[model samples]
Target: MIIFGTALLAVCHLLGIFLGDLLGQALGVKTNVGGVGIAMLLLIFARIYMQRRNMLPKLTELGVEYWGALYIPVVVAMAAQQDMVSALRGGPVALLSAIAAVAVCACVIAVINRTERPQAQTDGAPILHDNPLLTEAE
Candidate 1:
């Protein structure tokens, strides 16, 4: 089962590489990141759909938890990039602008989530708090 899943994942990755190459050529874009990003986004959506349908197993159950650890290297490399690091060191104005952009995005997301959240019934059951510990106690 593990071998079959590994082969399937490898095939999907190879297909993504070819698809990305074609997209880059057609769009005149040179970065492989765009292709990889598309592939990752597709995978994320697939996982979410499978999970919603209760058809997906936990990563630990599939012995694929270690694969999740591999992302640390990619994150570290991105953080260590000189150009990205230098972008922050440009000036106080640039730094403040970046911070403000992030703050605005966070505020927008919070408002959207608040507005879209499902309302709780006022019957007898206690409402669940966002805290996991509170949920466990209930």
Candidate 2:
């Protein structure tokens, strides 16, 4: 049950490390490439797949969720620390990738905001306007 989720996480992490190593070798680099991120994605997809197949046990799903929540923040902090250092020292490619990531995130946010704006405006809440005081003149 709970152990199954933990095992799944371990397998995902191992696969992530293997893939990261392969990616590094392919790119003539010497570091793990988004290993934690890949692992996280794998876990999420596995969970989704299992849920869709009605194969996920409730208690085990909760365990996975708890670990997933706990793991993400720690992984993100570690990744950010290492990425900032590497991006600073690794020259143009690293800088370009960081910039690209930012730009893509910005574009996605902008698109989401734009899509929601019209729906928000149409929410049926009455718009208030300044009410003038009643005057004697008819």
Encode model 2's per-residue lDDT on 14-33: one tens digit a residue.
99889888888899999888
User: What does the lDDT read for residue 47 in candidate 1?
Assistant: 50
Q: Compose the digit string of candidate 1's lDDT tens values, residues 7-68.
A: 43445456667787888878888744345455444445555675698765665225222332
The C-alpha TM-scores of every prediction are: 0.47, 0.65
Candidate 2 clashing pairs, residues 3+ apart or interchain: none
Tell me the spans in candidate 1 whose CA falls farther than 4 Å from its real position. 1-15, 49-55, 58-101, 118-138
Least accurate stretch of 10 residues (summed lDDT) in model 2?
A: 129-138
Highest-lDDT candidate: 2
Lowest lDDT 10-residue stretch of candidate 1: 60-69
